[model samples]
Target: MLLHIQFSPEPIPAALPALSLGSETGAFVEFRGFVRGEEGDHTIGGLVYETYQPMAEREITRIAEALVVDHPVQAVRILHRLGPVPVGEAAICLGVAARHRAEAFAFLASFMDRLKKDVPIWKTDTLPAA
Candidate 1:
């Protein structure tokens, strides 16, 4: 399996990288997380994402490796933005390629859940005046 991970200060790309699928590959899935300007009645001005770099990368790698070992996937890609991210901008992107759609969906969901629970990344949101 191919695994790619990047921590970028620049904007996330609009289009994620396409995987080179084998003849048996039949599904591709992606998840994109975007910064929002509001949550219910609260107003968000922006967000600052922080990470323990060495550990963050290691955790991401571990997640991908685990997916390869446990799932029927062909490739996985993850892009996460660090530092300041404005409202409406992309904060994270994930992609998965697999031999079937069900596996791709399952992997994507599980990977995201694991990332949120296990990754050492944190975010501070700038909120408008109350």
Candidate 2:
């Protein structure tokens, strides 16, 4: 399996790296986690995310790697933005390529759920809507 992770201070890019897939890769799934206009019951402009960098990356990698035991994942790519992110902008982007759609979907769902609970990434602050 191919695993790739990237972090940036700038806004998450609109274009993503192509996942290298072979003929056996029949399904490719992509997900983008965007900053919403609201946080909890309050309105907001954006959010600032913080992470320990090394540990965050390592933990997320572990989560992805562990999911491989059940999913026929061919390639996994993740991109996360650090620092301030505006509303409607992407904070995270993930791609999963697998031999079948079922595995890809399951892997994506499980990975996201695990990431929210396990990863050290957090919303350090919120931007006031202007």
Candidate 3:
């Protein structure tokens, strides 16, 4: 199994991520989370995210590994943008590859659920629209 997890201050690239897939691989799934125009009841301009880097990466790695074997996943990649993320732009991306579609989707779902609860990445609302 392969795993790549990262946090960056730059905007996420628009191109899709690539994984070394063998003939046995039959499915690839991806997800992107964007900053919405509204947060709660207020119109939002953007969002600012913060993290401690090392500890956050460690926790994220642990969360992903726990589901890998059970989901029978082959490769996984994650990217989260720090600092400010503008509305309608992607703040995070996730990719998973597996030998079957069900496994790939399952792994994606499980990983996302765990990430929200366990990760230390924090988000603060940016300037509200005037």
Candidate 4:
């Protein structure tokens, strides 16, 4: 499952049952991205994420397809947020499920890494200009 990218000051969705317990698979893994307190030499008060929607979605779909083809994972769900996000809030969330624990873990890790490196999302700090 994929989500429509959104930008809101409100908290991210609390219920991700489709990712957690929707599948009958024996294993599930989740990855969550949050706002950090620092970025490079700058202190981050918040973050703003922007994406070229069409391109970003396409890239994400490609990654998901690759994961299913290359891994034993049974299903995958990815969600990402945009706009102003404060510290401790989730920027992205990923979930993978499989029949075994090992595959679930491995696929989740790989997906996270690939998303960070390949996804078209861009982030900018909301810190005050020096």
- Measured against the true structure, the TM-scores of the candidates, in listed sequence, are 0.88, 0.94, 0.93, 0.81
- Model 3, 23-129: lDDT tens digits are 97888899999998888888988999998789888987898778976898899999999998888889999999898889889999999999888898889658566
Q: Which has the better lDDT: candidate 1, or candidate 3?
A: 3
Clashing pairs in 1: none
lDDT (Cα atoms) of all candidates against the true structure: 0.84, 0.89, 0.87, 0.72
**Model 4 over residues 1-130: C-alpha lDDT tens digits?**
3323343446677667644444457877777888888777877777888877788788877877777666777777777787777767898877777777888888788878887898888886485433
Model 2 gets an lDDT of 0.89
> Model 2, 21: alpha-carbon shift in Å?
1.4
Give the root-mean-square deviation of each candidate in angstroms: 2.3, 1.2, 1.3, 3.2
| Local lDDT at 12 for model 1 | 92
TM-score of 4: 0.81
Model 3: residue 128 alpha-carbon error in angstroms: 3.2
Candidate 3: count of backbone clashes, pairs at least 3 residues apart or interchain? 0
